[model samples]
Target chain A: MATTEAARPIAVATTPHRRTRWRHVLTGSVVPRVILIVSCLVFLAPFYWMVVSALKTNTELAQFPPSLIPGAWAFNNFPDAINYIPFGLYTFNSLVITVGATIGAVLSNTLVAYGFSRIQWPGRNALFYLCVATIFLPYPVILVALFDIFGRLPSFGIQGAKSWVDTFLPLIVPAFFGNPFYIFLMRQFMLGIPKELSDAAKVDGASELQTFWRVILPLTRPAVIVVLILAAVAAWNEFLLPLLYLQSNDKYPLAVGLIFFTSEHDVSYNLLMAASTLIVLPVVIIFLVAQRFFIEGITVGGVKG
Target chain B: MTAAATSVKPRSVGRFRLGTLERRNLKWGLLFISPWAFGFIALGVFPILYTFFLSLTRYTGFRSPTLIGFNNYTTMWNDPDFWKAAYNTLYYTVLAVPIGVVVAMLLAIAMNQKVREVAIYRAIFYLPSILPVFAISFVFVVLLNPGYGLVNLLLTTAGLPSPNWLGDPAYTKLALVMIAQLGAGQWALVFLAGLRGIPIELYESAEIDGAGAFRRFRSITLPLMTPVILYDIIIGLSFGLQVFTSAYILTGGATRGGAGPDNSLLTYVFYLYQQAFQFGSMGYAAALSVVLFLASVILAMAVFRWARGWVFYGGEEA
Candidate 1:
């Protein structure tokens, strides 16, 4: 049951408020510049510590007031770290999971967001709010039963548990249905998309799906990339879920696998830091390259929430 | 198009009157969002409800759950380790969230300062937050270790006594709180956005009135940023309460059952994992989850209620 749909609303950016020319508070000066540099360096210290420790010998690491820079850079540390675990295998597993999940999220989020934005339904707004509120469904509570669901896959008994446990399925499968945060972000982004394009397609006798795929999806590349980056970064660095589900080393993602290294060789700070670098490098690169999308996604999606 | 759409109106007889185009939109909307709708129920709603029931009974990966109402709850109430973990978690949340938010906001304001190559500086500052927590945890473990850790080295050089960070239960959580800033980058970005969202006119007018930077910040910026602060607190509360990976990794908890020295670093999630997995007390863990969920819900409600008085909507919806 529904009434005649209203005209599509164009999302307005906040109107610029009138200026009242005021003196600058934080004027660029020697004092502020020095403070800025010092702050940046302080933040960079941890990464420096990681890299420095990674290149140090065990004895060097053990020294009080550990060497700021290693006597000799241990180029072997990265190789050693990888050799210590099935590092390649873990990387592969992490990639498969992150990539698959990103793809799944992109598909699910766009479609669902389109439904909310372009289509009119009696329960659309209510359901969308319901979806958004589910953002707070702490997974810890749900995992108790979710683990049980995975354990017994209907006809398949404990035997299927092998594939379920220690496999990438747990993290990747859920992405096929949109995550609430990404969906919210995508929906907000989609809200700004001019509806005339879709209406014109409708006038041309295009189906809703065609309008979504051809008209909406193409225009929403920025939104898609935003969701993809969010999904990918999250899926990549995720720790607890993988730790809980992955029982074996071979199936472990870097987050889980790296910790396994720490527990086993607890004192090998060199190898530990090297592996830390390895694990962090990809995300750092992704973040740096896609800074705009990531920044916009959080600022817009998060502020509203 | 109007004629064609109108022709399709009479097919479905419904209690409520509907336009033809509206009916089509309803069909397409439902059809398009079915996957998410299915997922919301299967993944979110049903599991939460099931967990609530599961919390009431004893079950350890078994299909059947025998009801023993209030028993699991009472058991957790009487559990010392649970209390220790709860205290540890609260200590962290209280210490970390407010400090983290303030620091993040300050950093945001600092970054918002008009400067050249500010983008690069911003990226560098924000990089740590993007790094995996586990990786960062491991680095901090070595960095904060009393013997060879860089943290102790720096502190000692600064003429401060170095506490055994990970080993001393007294300092384990404090150490985590300090390192929590490593991930404050995301919060800072949000703050920066909030700073940007503040119309420059506010600051300009305040300055025109001879208000100093600090006064301007207090009178205008801080008030406007209350909503963002509310957002930051909510995010911080959730993450702070559920802190696991850093605790688990830094304490060598995977090997040590997630209990740092004297069980000091045992956060709520760490304790939850131990209950369900280590002790084979899945039901007890479920009960723990229920407690955490309820506590988080209550605290969030309180925050939202409190926020109402101060959160300046600035013409936006509350």
Candidate 2:
């Protein structure tokens, strides 16, 4: 990918006269572009339909053949959808979990990754391998046991909580434990930082913690951002864990809450779409704004595998 | 500094003597990783081991457990619903993974094209992937509505029979498979990265040798992409086996045990969830978890073992 990026400017620089011809040739090959355009449309059709349906009146939604565009723009449906359920409460719950998880993920993963990467300790490589191996272990294998463990949290005498079940603790607390994927990603990123920087910090009489905080962590901003975005997205989108752990309707995250909205008696299709659109909006905005991080994070993790 | 010291005087490991520096390094390393280590033990290893222990005992959440030997496993062996869930999960994996890989590869190829609007195309393709699956499931419910859903409406316009996607048991799993394709863009990005990693010179040289595009792709692109494909297959298998959310939402809720019409959407994880939470068969659920873990590990190993035959490394020996 880097090589392709590097080659393009050079090609244009050296063959300035042929650039127009090259552009013409590129544009003249229409089949690939047509296929791409059509595929993009196919890919986006559902979202387009979703937005269109969200704007439709109930009568229009009940039409024999749904209109491509809504007959009347039912803008009130968004507010109505939110009012129908505890959308605000669900959004708040989702935010709390997402924010909590992201913070934990960033802190734990960075620290753990530093240990795995920067330090030269005996058994480090073997331990890092063990951490990475955990990535392959099916999460469902531990679900039942984790549920049991969290369910017993009240017995452990934690303050201000009856049980970890029916609370955000199960969803939020796990992020404080380093995820193997993020650890691996951060470790890879940390390894690329020059050892001399850390050595220099040490020579200047800084502690290992100080060296990490002041020197290494600053240089790791991009990787940290990647972890943050990925963790936030995962936390926001997480379903099974939250579904299992959270019992109260008022405490439900948007992911779980949306299902409840759909299961209501005689669900208004337009209102459902409106709520779905609302739930999807933040993620779409985040992806658009931080597109590079999303692509880079996934590709980097995948390519190294 | 420490790395340089280690390089100069490689420590003798047979006796395993630790110097002051080594001890300090070890202490700091352990300190830095304490959170993860604690988590690994508490959340990961302990849970896994406890799951195994739980699988052997009959326990409800509210009551004490009684040792049942391997009765849960034995029961699972004879249970028709367990087999149905297993089959549904397998059927979904067999279809979804390969289809996802192909769709992703095709999308990757399209994205790799030197089109002016490639970034926009890439964004459009990937947009659906990052959206919450639950929301997507809701959208799918409306889109796959039998009477006037977008999918069936399109099928009708194209002069094809529009089957009940969510209603019919035969089509329920198939509907989930179609929904799974929406997330192919995530893997497509990986494939795109792999495609980019292939040296352009290989194609240029192949062009000079009078090899057609198909020949170039077969000999060069496909072989080089086998590793990424293998990665995708392994990841896809794990995800495919654990599929729950869409099915859970589509089939009303956990109250319905997440089993769609005629149990078509009763995926392995869904079944396990139902067993543990809904039915209060914690022991049986634990057993299901154990089998799922074993299946994931064995299947992953099998893929790796098979990959040895076909996956090509650029410079390293396979």
Which prediction has the highest DockQ against the true structure? Answer: 2
Worst 10 residues of 1 chain A by lDDT: A1-10
List candidate 2 stretches off by more than 4 Å: A1-28, A155-161, A303-305, B1-15, B255-258
Candidate 2 vs. true structure, TM-score: 0.92
DockQ for all candidate structures vs. native: 0.33, 0.52
lDDT of 2 at B206: 79
lDDT of 1 at A101: 92
lDDT scores in order: 0.79, 0.85
Error of 2 at A301 (Å): 1.2
- Could you tell me the lDDT of residue A102 within candidate 1? 88
Which lDDT tens digits does candidate 2 get at residues B1-318? 444443354465667888657877898999999889999999998999999999999999877778899999999999999999999999999999999999999888877776667788778878888888887887888888887788888899999999989889999998889889988887888898899889888887776797866897899999999999998898888788889888887887754444888899999999999999988989899999999999999999998999999999877973
Residues B255-314, candidate 1: write the lDDT tens digits: 755488888988898888888877777788888988888988898899999998998888
